[model samples]
Target chain A: MISDSIANAPVPAAAPNPKDFAKKKRTNRSAKLKQCKLDARREQWLSQVKNKGSKDESNGFRDSSMHERDGSDRSLENLEMRQRGEENDGSIHHDSDLESPSNSPTSNASSVLGGNHSGTNYTGSSSSSSSSVGCCSGCITEEEEDDGCLDDWEAVADALAADDKQQNPSSDSSPDHEPVARSDSLPELTNRVDSVVQVSKPECAVMVPRAQVNGQAWRPDDAFRPQSLPNLSKQYSFPMNSDRHYGRGAVSWAHKSVISAPSSCPICYEDLDITDSSFLPCLCGFRLCLFCHKRILEDDGRCPGCRKPYDLEPVEGEASLNGGSLTFRLARSCSMITRS
Target chain B: MVDFARVQKELQECNRDVEVSGIKVSPKADKLTHLIGTIPGPLGTPYEGGTFEIDIQLPDGYPFEPPRMQFSTKVWHPNISSQSGAICLDILKDQWSPALTLKTALLSVQALLSAPQPDDPQDAVVAQQYLREYQTFVSTARYWTEAFAKTSSLGVEEKVQKLVEMGFPEALVRSTLEVVGGDENLALEKLCTV
Candidate 1:
């Protein structure tokens, strides 16, 4: 029926403004360019890691005794080769790609290369190239130190921060809000060049802007203002109960004593209606009503209240039918009341 | 709730009468929301005179993912499995995007039926037969269409049995002849195998 309805529907006339359409096209193009640059950087970093293994193999004679010391040495070499090959070719082989080798030397390569490439691309100038080369040389000098590895992460983060600074020179005052600032900077950075190119096609020229506006002072709070526009809460409309009033009533006591009064269903966000409520036993004094309890039990049989394993006990009595009218009351516990 | 507004808009843009191998196809719907489609077999193939019927089902995640499609009218093709009507096509899997509509997917399916990809196949026997004996495969597929997929009074199991006498598997021959419930040829293929 829906398909038939769709089949018979009339085509709507095109009435969109040409200017607005052009603006949207431009914005999309810039976003796509930035994405392409990021993808290229990721590929280059992977290639560097692959090159690292080849370099290691060439130096194998110098470290001949080191290879025979551990049985895992051969497997490690194999893994490095596999990682390199998979990176060069986009297709994944087996499940090894999913493993996160966080402490591996390859991880360091990723952070260093990722940071440098993202930094250079973000700053829109070739001046950072000399500094990036210096950073790479510094990585080799400090390769033996654990602190050097930590510095690698910091360097990458700093490079990204520097790029963000170049993009949004007016808002760089606070270091605490750097992450939020970086997120906001992406859209603004893309918006500047959006009108210049057609982004859907991959062959467009990528023009990286040079950082001439670095002298402007930036504060982190300013970054938060633009970034807050796309917050998740603003996107989805949540129903708020305005009519219900919270009070210490008989129903409240029943909820607290029997049905766990303040309990909320995780899925539907409805209060557990007492008549239809089901009790789930747990180590903590918490219980979830029937609907939520059943769904979790079917999934993994883990307690939603504390995430602990529960011993299944048969529930008794008539199924609760509080309907959908009930509202959850949030109240301070007896201990908190006593402390006050 | 499902976004009926967007779904309706997509459905309207889809063109149902797709022509492949000179066969015109139009999907018919039963009162119960199930879909049945008929396509005249193309000339020069073993299925030349056959009117093939297929079933179509729109899963909850339609357009975002490929709709389950299967051939209800059985035919012999290297790419199409004998036991299951599963087709190996890129658009049905990784190449699928939400931008594609039901009509496009079906049109692609019709093209697949006309030109079987024997290299990568769901049924190894069919693929092998297609590779080893190209003429025989074509003749068998055409025979299947005339015997099983004919909408005329002459269309019957006896006619299909005549083709089986020429050395086609009975199960493959029969299931291929039956009309599908939804466009889920893949699921029906698996179902027939079981």
Candidate 2:
């Protein structure tokens, strides 16, 4: 919470010089993006290192697949974009996003529509390779959907069975005959399988802008614009925009959420005069009366509002400067040693 | 700054409607930082007719920070510590919002008396009893309420008189009674230690 205020306090400070502020903000954003990229790469490297000791063959396969995806990098970009959609929920908007599935599902569907819109057709080799990855993601989605209905898992099992059939085409050269027999036996199951196949197919070649138009019809105010970017930059930059919005707006949101000038002490439930010297130390903006503040500090310097430790930087600095060591550098070193 | 002005106002506001709310707040000492809160046990529960006293300590960040409150009156319940009288309610900790007052908090405490959340318990033994032997837990809670909370009842006076008869001076017995908030068994325990 304190970090949030530290991030946004400068926005209002630099408001007078709008041009400089904008430039500085952009640079700050880029720096954040670079940091995120480094963090992702570091995590990937750590995971790879961990896996290398256990399964060298699996690592080789993963590396080869990554290389193969790199050739038709557009498909790889699409996958990354979808992954970003998944990551968005895990980050800043986690609470609200999970609470409101209607919002995320529609947005996801729109983005998928946009992806298909941007890329007309995937090359045969790229399509085949991406289909496997897509199937895995489809299975994951199916698992998530299973929470809503038990039948979704059955549908996913059927999809997996079809996948197994595809892998062993030599054993059952008449794979088409089995699927047809199953489809005829259970039309409803065939319909579910059809939806699953559509999800896994990278060659959805057509984008229906009209689907997005229908979505917009329900909520005209929702700015549901279709994405047309077909390259890696489009997918890569998606997270950057989200990260920028999340970093800036979410900070301001937290900063604004707290009652900076509360009318009363929340603990005692008493009204205070506007001029009372309050202990508005933490970003939670909870104020303590002087007596309460002194009493609390006597026990521990945690913010009563949130039970966070008081950031005692100035106090620590003063202690180091005044007591024990007289020489300033020596005092600093002594304080550091004592602190450790 | 213990917003003495606000605390004074809250005390007045809380005590003013004691008849209606059955919740009262008063300063324990001259300082506003330390206070006492009284919440009548919720109606129609095992704690019915019992008055629960809660110790209130105002931290530095009074309104922003949640007020520190613990049960001074010991009774059997899952969410309240059987030994220390520490309550395990969300509002008394991180879930506390500034919008809540001492009166509201006391009301919440009273509500907790009626509805003990065994799933998130301060006393694991009590919670287990509540979940596994619910009828036994209720009777035990009711018995504790009768033994401790009913200060006006002759049963408590008899216990106090009996302790005094056992050669503990009347003043020490009375003082122990006050310390244990009229819990006969606990007062006897305190007097025995003395």
Candidate 3:
């Protein structure tokens, strides 16, 4: 699971190292090395944390004050060792602390390292972790734990733990806050986060990131590149498949409201990069690209979101994009959206 | 597929106001798709003083498709099945919208307890009794709630006997127990209020 998170971390940008700029491909190799080191440290940190938690649990009843003293002493030792490690690794200590996992030895280590690393590398990781911990941890965890269904819950518990740390500073601070650059892949990030987490302690999973967690799962990995969506102007609105609704006289004003078209269709999961024209037969917040809309109407005019019988009517309005009609024609050429 | 991002958000949003709403949602196990929602029965209803559990299953086409929900706790309501606990709410089926959430849906379920739709019955027998024999329905619902929903912390008999010996009739003590769902203190409060 830790390795998964390390893999997803943006390879520290090589732009700062002028020599690496000329050797772009080599920068990838160096980033891989850094990730490898981070992974190793993460495992070491996790093992230490497990040991600490077990020790605390077992020794809690005997004499809690004594146990707390011992725990703090050990924490101080760990901090000293981390500082030594940082000296050996340079600013990499700051990097590691920023992406530190919670209930972690690094949290102890970072408190000491913070005095030194706070000045230079504090902005990105510290601010992001402090601010986005409640919201982004689940998202980052879900995205990282794509294959492990059960780990999603752990991630959620971890998110709750993060919240607890935020609410009451006495609890363990989450060390693993990798500042993911959202602007580069906002939609893709949303798609990945949308995969969901397996929450072991559902009670703790609070504070939903509304903008990112709105349920729109973007699937057009190839089509959603920022460069492809150049002309937002030429998009045209298409009426629902004429065959879907027979009774509504094709001209009812009630059915004429235009859907604020989504960039992609739910039916085809295709982005408007290729097919710009979209139609929504109902105001149920679901849109099908013109191709899927036509097919649904031809077969059955039922709204998928709300199973009510639906009909599409073309409204005379300002055309949104130029490539709308062409995109519909393109989608018509392929039969990828036939019902099961 | 399942809108997991929405699920995560819904959980966070639902849990944030847990204190105010007294509604809780958590994964049944590790899986996000299967969840359990807990709602306290509304005040001034047959189900008052009880807690109800709901089972939630997120479909692959979630947000696009409504979540499948059923009463995990045995509920005596017209729109909820007494046997299988299937709910008869439209939002769970054909009347769903992508905009609606698991929290909202559970809120609706809680509301259904206060204002039951006997006309659209999931359990015909319960609905029929609810309409025809409203008094019997209330007593039976209260009794069932006391039997099933309660988790009495105090030894119930001592409290019941104590209340009975305090000059209240034994029948009144028992009925108060049914009304307060076995909370000794609440039953005493009901006795005092009456």
Candidate 4:
């Protein structure tokens, strides 16, 4: 497009002074030629990157291996499955860290209470000794064993299915249960293989609670249900936790789409965390996130991304979502949770 | 970037007359843009046979604000003060308009040098000399123009010495001179107000 515009521009006639004419011609020709070459190189690089795979990979989500797989003959779904396995391993390690013996304050309290009830005001002296032997070593090994059990994908799937059934018992007997049943019946698809292939369906549900309790939100039922994984995939077509790899076709397309898309956070190179992000709308259909919007507003109440004036009217409910009106919402509950 | 299209159009019209007349005006920028203007000092004056250089600075709000002009070369006249090289002219102040171009402003400054408005004196002493000792003032103005403002190599210290000799106190004169930014008469008036 740029090359066509340059080619279509009319050339000027010769000047009276040959020396001045020569200088002007040299400057104009070099500048236009340099610009054309740069644009061509950019277009070529973009096409090469785009041909590699799904657009999400370029948007800073795919890992190095997934990128290499996309570049090779391997399918995007298979590459996603392998990436999910790696992510599950990481989650397991995180779970173990949280569930370690050193972290079990409840067990230690129970041991102290048991000693106090036994009339051994000797509870004080025995508490220290019992805690070291009966709790520390024993609990550590028991916790390690529990962690090992969680490493199995089948067990994790069963646990999830069980939890789902417990929470939505009515749905278990309904026709809507077929999707869940179908998902569970295929144990081979346990490693998020189906989810990866059926990527367009928004499987991940995020229900941001609107109220706060003592500065922390009451823990939601699905708080631990792997929210980041699906959210990242929807936005970039790759795992959220993976270190970015720039090579894949999908990754490049995602990057171009994002870089070209107006609302993307310049700092994180991710879509603005929509739940918490504020919006500044312009006539150009460019919506800047709160951070970028604020910076530009300070200079002039104009959209930095599009260089157009913005009108910041308060939008109510879901009506604001229409016509690309930027909406702001709190992502996480801000209620305080106190265990009795 | 600057609106190069507008700048190019303006430059073309500006250079047309100068190019035809075999005179040259080159646009250059250092601390500020200085339009180095060369014109044969008009005939029949004491300043005849001497070339003069005028320095002009366009303020940031150009077109809206007037360009500041001062004679880089020294000259003496009833209107051109030898003390601070100040030219008593209305176009440099209230008469300025955005529509006025650099070439026109420079031409006006040249015309002011040829026709001195000594009655509205910036340098009262120079005006007095022009009234009382007309030939002496003209001779001194011509001598200074030949010695100072005529050449790029003329030291600023020599110019300062000539201004001091014109009855301007060294300190008040320096402060006033600096205040007007090398315009001697305005600097003296500003100093006097303090």
Candidate 5:
């Protein structure tokens, strides 16, 4: 939301010299876009590391066909555009877009509409592809595992169906069909598949347009049942147009539907780092990221997932940052320390 | 704050299944904290066919704090105030849960329209009529729904014409509708008094 204001905040009351204001805004936008890009990439790495657990668990719910749609190089573009859609829900009137650059709604639309695939995709703007994360290699391996997980899910789903009568529909549908049959179920499985796809496809292609991203992240987000984004999160609002008319609601909806990397927080719908420590669960099994879980705890100690108050006593030897178990905190801190 | 992100997701989620729920929520303006929700009046009730609008105000602690909802469109019901439009529904007050989104809360409000609790009344007059003069209450409630529900949506000209067709002079209908801010039903009620 901060990036939206930075990129799209209306002119100050004491409007500056038009030319100077335009230049200043341009410089500010570029810097913000660059920072946002880095943040998106960094957040991507953090989520990937945090979500190592998602690979095995998140697979059962994903549509295996969406992996086929994972067009590789959209990463950098989506990394930037997706965040733009997430934080910047302010209307992106065409006039304002013309004046601002980078995080302008126009830039996101341009990328999402396939306008920049050849020339100015976010990857091209990023010069440091070989950074410590070995950006390109990490992304490739992630996609490779994404495919591996698809195959894994196919067999695992079959195995689960053979074992359990109530095997989840998402798991069983695939591995039963050739890849062609799988595509037919795409529209129906899109919601569940997108959630799985959100987890596995995180590294390479995050922007399926939230039309592809909606509440597919946290299963318990569906606890509300009446109004959960899990199924609708995949719609990227089609027009990420900076139409001054589109509020932040439509923007994030647009953002998630377009490109979602991390599994999203059920409460906020912002991408979640879904690790055991980052993603906390209620006794009733409602899962939310630590940020929202902590906020709920602070508010009334009621879990949004279960509508029941949770036990606040911290677990043994674990001083929680919020309500989570913090099993990986030491490992994360060590890694952060070593990396920095 | 209002957890605008969740509000956004809720908006997307709620509007997506509008066909099923027949409930739609949109921001009153840019602020997610204030919203306008529309619910079709419950079936098999005096309210059927009318679209009721609800004005929603999200407290800073929303989802944690129940969203404050009152009818924007006037309605005659035991648990809802006719003058102030304050709703005396349990879910809107202490019984609310974070698990409840605007959509679900609105659903409960719609449910209340069908099954009213005259014993726990927000408007004593409406409750008294409901319990004492059951037939009078249904007609009055139905009349109120017709007048209240269609008032905002019907154009002044259409209302003027409708009243004119009902035997009022065209000039009288126009002036009366204008006096009542184009509320044809109110105009009709006034013309009868005249």
Candidate 6:
């Protein structure tokens, strides 16, 4: 699973040295050198993390503190080693993060690395629940063995563990937080943190430039040239065949109406990328991801987000992109709408 | 075809505030497609203190189309089918909006328990009882909830033993227990009535 995440990490991740860029196409030789170094470091990192988690667990205390320390340690190690691996993917991932709210990192990774598509839907955002996915998830490897937490109850426990790290900040004293099982607000907080971590963690993942990895992947290698990276308008949407990409991860989709306006779709909580058809704006200015739009088009005529009779052709035919149809469609919609 | 990514997010979001919301959704098995949603019976209703479980099957067009939810735990509400557990709620049908998450949908179901819309109901008999004999409706609903919704403290085997010891055939007692949804007291009442 760690390899899966590594593979999914943006291809040109970590800031690559300009020398690597100069020989971008001629990377067959240099790529081998980097791959060797990356595999060595990754193996070392994994062993150390596994060993440390077990050692700490045997001590019968300080599990939370140990895990916190381990998390920071992994991030630091990622920085030191991934500098070579982190090439073009870092900035590109970050840029895409900004432009596309409904990020399908798995799609990008799978598309980049064909046959390595170990697609976990809860990839980036809702991956907060992956504390239960102990097998492949790098962060919670020990969790699977310790309690055998196989249900939603695992989330509650991890949320509590994560909570302790926040509450005391005296990271050394995690013992007090262990037995604390019940909480009133944990479920709510878990998700808020989940979205924030989604934005931030991938940035860390993107940092470690895995040059040789990308040197092998990138089916559309020419399209990835730095110049073409930002111009996503041409791809309007992901190919329908790559439907799995549409299933990357979910965030807290049903946020209270009052909080900050949502950036992702209310339905899937997938990011609303205006450039991609991922952003299916309703006449009412409500947005849905294209997957949801296709489903709605086939099942019902109305937009799930709009709360109005859906004008099917409003997006492509009549309603101008600037949301001109909001008032225009509402004014002339139907007598039934006017009556009720 | 079900947008799994969204369902994953929904499950997390819904389960996150399980304590506060008193609503939970967990995958029935390895597949995220089939799920079990649990909602606490609304306070001040006859169904209070009983936990209701809803079985949710996501259609290929979920979010575009509402998920199919039925009572996994038997519920006695006019809008809910007493025999088959089919729910007659609009949002689950034509009124569904993608904006509504499973959490909200379950909340709406909870609200239905608190205030049954007898005029437009799935169970015509229950609706008629609700409109005609209001007190009888409350008591029957309460009895059904007690018998079917609550997770009984007594084990099924114990309930069977106790019922069998009451000078009733073991087979008859077992069937009565099943008929009354494993409630020992209700099984006794049913056996006595027969």
* TM-score (all chains, Cα) for each model: 0.28, 0.37, 0.35, 0.28, 0.41, 0.42
Q: What docking grade does candidate 6 earn?
A: acceptable
Off by over 4 Å in 1: A1-340, B1-33, B152-194
Displacement of the residue B177 alpha carbon in candidate 2, Å:
5.2
lDDT tens readout by residue for model 1, A68-170: 1111111111222322321221111111122221222233233224324433222211111111111222222222322222212222322333343242222
The global Cα lDDT (0 to 1) of model 6 is 0.53
lDDT of 5 by residue, B37-75 (tens): 989999899999898889899999876789999997889
> Which model, 1 or 5, shows the larger DockQ?
5
Give me the displacement of residue B153 in model 4, in angstroms: 11
Clashing residue pairs in all predictions, respectively, total 33, 17, 17, 21, 27, 20
lDDT of 3 by residue, B1-194 (tens): 67576687788889999999989898876789999888898999999998887889988767666789998677889999987789999988877755477888899999999999999999999999999999999998998777556644346777678788788999899989887556565576579989
Stronger candidate by DockQ (1 vs 2):
2
The list of candidate 2 runs beyond 4 A from truth reads A1-340, B152-159, B165-167, B175-193
**Candidate 5 regions with alpha-carbon error over 4 angstroms:** A1-263, A276-280, A312-340, B159-194
In the order shown, the candidates' DockQ scores are 0.01, 0.11, 0.05, 0.02, 0.33, 0.45
Q: For model 6, how does the per-residue alpha-carbon lDDT over A1-340 read when each residue is reduced to its tens digit?
A: 2222332232123212322332342243235334444444454445446556454332222322222222222222222232222222222223322322123333233223321222111121112111111111221324333322111121222233345434323322333222221111343234223423432444343332223233433344443345645434435454432333333232333122212335676777778675433343454545666666665655655766656756645564334543675766667777568788
Q: Model 4: residues >4 Å from true position, as ranges?
A: A1-340, B1-8, B19-23, B30-32, B149-194
lDDT score at residue B132, model 3, on the 0-100 scale: 99
Listed per model, the TM-scores of chain A against the true chain A are: 0.16, 0.21, 0.18, 0.15, 0.16, 0.16
The docking quality of candidate 2, as DockQ, is: 0.11
| C-alpha RMSD between model 2 and the true structure | 29.5
Candidate 3, TM-score vs. the true structure? Answer: 0.35
Candidate 4 lDDT over residue span A1-340, tens digit each: 1211111111011011222322333343234335434544454345435435422221111111111111111111122232332233233233433555443333333323332343222212122222121122222323433233222222222222234334222221232222222333232232123222211111110001101111332234433233434443355555442223322333444444434454445322236765323332444434445544444444344443444445454332223454334322221222222321
In candidate 3, residue A242 scores what lDDT?
33
Error of 3 at B115 (Å): 1.4
